[model samples]
Target chain A: MILAIDVGGTKLAAGLVTPDGHVLETRVAATPQDADAERLWKALEELIAPMPEAEGVGVGCGGPMIWPDGRVSPLNIPGWRDFPLRERLAASFPGRTVRVHNDAVCLAAAEHWLGAGRGHANMLGMVVSTGVGGGLVLGGRLVNGGTGNAGHIGHVVVEPGGPLCGCGGRGCLEAVARGPALVAWAQEQGWSPGHGPLDGGPYEEGRAVTGRGLASDALRGDPVARAAMARAGRALGLAIASATHLCDLDVVTVGGGLSQAGAPLFGPLEEALRAHARMDFARRLRVVPAALGQSAGLVGAAALILAGDRYWDAI
Target chain B: MILAIDVGGTKLAAGLVTPDGHVLETRVAATPQDADAERLWKALEELIAPMPEAEGVGVGCGGPMIWPDGRVSPLNIPGWRDFPLRERLAASFPGRTVRVHNDAVCLAAAEHWLGAGRGHANMLGMVVSTGVGGGLVLGGRLVNGGTGNAGHIGHVVVEPGGPLCGCGGRGCLEAVARGPALVAWAQEQGWSPGHGPLDGGPYEEGRAVTGRGLASDALRGDPVARAAMARAGRALGLAIASATHLCDLDVVTVGGGLSQAGAPLFGPLEEALRAHARMDFARRLRVVPAALGQSAGLVGAAALILAGDRYWDAI
Candidate 1:
């Protein structure tokens, strides 16, 4: 048995899974605010306390983290700055082994093992949510770069001089296509979920507007909302086209809340991809929806310990 | 002993090398024009005739080719469309191994084995010349995606709506930063090599205006030439920034004739890279000059067989 933990800014989740990719039981809780490392650690402990007797543990979280040292400084989790996650997890688990990887990589491992990327040898698994994240598998091997961060696809500079990204870059795929970016664009175009643009409301972080809300509005034929989703898809398509041209991908599978936009998201995406992709092989690349949905990260974290080198082809 | 052959549109070269990457013998000849496949095969036969007894042969050529069948259809070599290069080469030397790969991949293999990429595990090798070419090594493994064309960095669409490329894509790095692209940009800015644009004696193909010629003018303090090179560097830097962000590369090595422009090219490139790279680790990426110049391809081809899985880890 394997204990898998999925750490996110908004939520924390844990799962007990079998070796063959089955999730037996799962636990979830809201992540704590920036209080202290102890508070975050306590939250994780609570999430993992009920995990069944497992021989190994696997954890996946937002990055700007180190793999070897197992120290994490996720952008959203301020309390986790250089937190020795692996050491603590390993110590808590006693004799069992503990492993950690970027949440996006875990998603790729899950997809490659049992999700939409199952049959493909070279694939890119992406999460287009609050921010875009990705992982790659090439030649049937997980592509971990020198420092285990080989698949930061969201950060690929598509427009070079356009919108400033949250990560301090210009025109990143995430900046143009992720949920926050879409909501920002929609609001800039004089659209709002509330009564009007001047409506008074507190800036509730991570919930001021959601991709699902915008997507529903777009489905309802709201022009402003439709335009934002269309523009987001276009930006995503151009970025994916560049990646396909360079990586010769077999397929690209996208997940996360933003992906719930479905046809409204994928249609314009495929169109932009067709416009930018050049060569015959590159044009053959496909973009599709991910199968596992939210459970992907948890299952993939389990894979890091259970699937072994089959998913973790490189350090 | 290893028999290495480097095939380019303009030239074909062969070499006999030891197991330690030492070239013992070499032969060179200009590539034949619009001739039959047999004519091209004959030229290859002559080039390899004197390659001392070897156990294995490695051939590197331009791509848009099939890896499994070893069929080649390089854009410049119009007559040898889908030529059966591996079959013929195998038949010529029975009971011996012959491997074929893209020339850019070969350059990467050679560099990883004995040149600039020696110590780095995850590296990207780029040839910024007449047309851009690239190869990737991640986690100490050569990357060959679906069709063995994973590292086509030159074609990445950095500027989505900028210029038309030879491959029908707009704003491709090759379209905005290659030798011809730089020359074209300089010409557009009212700089001439010999006489007026209409006074050209003939369309000399790859020799219309070379990167070396532009570099000389730039070094001679011509503002137009300087701006062209600067623009080319910025384009290349943006493309490489995208690549570095995605691949999580440790280093990138630039080769080809244009690389000889030195500071004039590298200065702008480094600046642009610093401008676009956002993540802390991505910002740490370093761009350096390729160590082995012209012979890099031949050496890398030999490495395909000689270095075994060390150089050909992925494909």
Candidate 2:
């Protein structure tokens, strides 16, 4: 069995996974937003304490980390800037092997190993929730680039001089298409969550103006919400087309909140992708929804130990 | 020793190279335009007939070909669509190894092995001539994608709804920044080659309006020509920034005609790259002119045999 941990800005999850990737036991806890590094460590320890003994431990954490050594400083998780994640895990696990990688990269591993990207030798697995991120599987293996941030498609410039990105760039794919960004754009266009055409009474009260709310509203035929989805989708298509052409990709699997908007999002995405991805080899590419859901990060973390040959090459 | 061949739309070249990438002998001839496939093959045979025998032969040819098997159908070379290049070479040289790959990929290998990209583990080598093309080296090896067209950066979309490309896409890097495209844009902007501010008498008379002429004009303070250079340079920068972020690239080496425009091209390129490649990891990337000159393809083809461990893997 492998101990798999997923560390995100909003939550911490730990799972005991079998050699074949099945999660036998799991634990979860809300991340302390303003906690100190030690406090964050304690929360993770408590979350994993109930898990059974395992042959190895694998972790999927947020990025800008020192790969292999695994010192993390995720943008959203301000509490753990440059935290020694891999060192702490190694010290705690003793003789067991410890592996750490970016959560987005883990998602790619899971999809390529057993989900949407399965059987595809060249695939890009993406997430479009709070932030747009991705992992690349090329020639049937993970592409661990110079800094282990190979498939960071979110930062790819989709619209030059369009919008300023959190990374300090203008018009990054993430700036235009990330969940929060899309919701913010919708709100700017006068979209209020519970004030949509389908919103009726008490059930819609106190609903947060989240990407989920925007997706729901779009599904209910809200004009501004649908437009928001279309805008995000077109940006995604442009970035994916660029990636497909540059990498000669075969398939793209999109996950995360905005992707669940279905046709309202995918329709524009498909149209833009077909329009932009015009190369002969690129024409063979297919973009689809990611099959693995919320547990994808844990499953992919487990893959670090169970299928190291393809996913875990950093160490 | 190795026999290296470079096939392109305008010219065919053959060289005898030592194991260390030195071109010991070379022969070049203009490609027989409008000729049949067999006639083209005869021209290639005559070009290499005088060269000494070698242990192996390697070739770098224009792309849109079936890799490894090397059936070439280069878009610019209409005489030989899907011509069996590898088969013909193998038959011509029995008991010897013959390898084939895209010419741009060869340039990448050459740069990585012996030119500007030397010592860089992750690099992108680009050519910005009549048509833009590129090859990627990641983790110190060539990235041969699903269809063996991994690093074709020409088709990467830099502008949304910008310009129509020969590939039927709008805003492709090639469409906006390739030699002919940039030259055409300059002409459309009322800048005629040899009619620039510095053009004088017979020295500039009858000069063809080409990418080179435009570059010369730009260097001599031609406003429209400079604008065209800046336009192409900015597009190159955007595409390179996108590529750097996506691949976590360490360096980019640009070759070909337009790259020789020097400051008129590189200044805007550097500025735009900094504007978009804002990620901490991506900040370290360096863009430079390719070190090898006209013989890059020949040297890279030689590397296929001389440095097979890093450059040749298909067969």
lDDT: worst 10-residue window of model 1 chain B: B194-203
Q: Give the TM-score of candidate 1.
A: 0.94
Of candidate 1 chain A, the 10-residue stretch with the lowest lDDT total is A194-203
Q: Candidate 2 DockQ category?
A: high
Provide the TM-score for each candidate, comma-separated.
Answer: 0.94, 0.96
**For residues A203-227, could you state the per-residue lDDT of candidate 1 as single tens digits?**
3555547776676667666789878
iRMS per model in Å? 1.0, 0.7
What is the TM-score of candidate 2?
A: 0.96
Name the runs in model 2 displaced over 4 angstroms. Answer: A194-207, B195-207
Looking at model 1, give its docking quality level: medium
- Residue pairs clashing, model 2: none
Instruction: Determine which window of 10 residues in candidate 2 chain A has minimal summed lDDT.
Output: A195-204
Candidate 1 per-residue lDDT over residues B117-182, each given as its tens digit: 898988989988888988988878788889888888988987888899988889889988888889
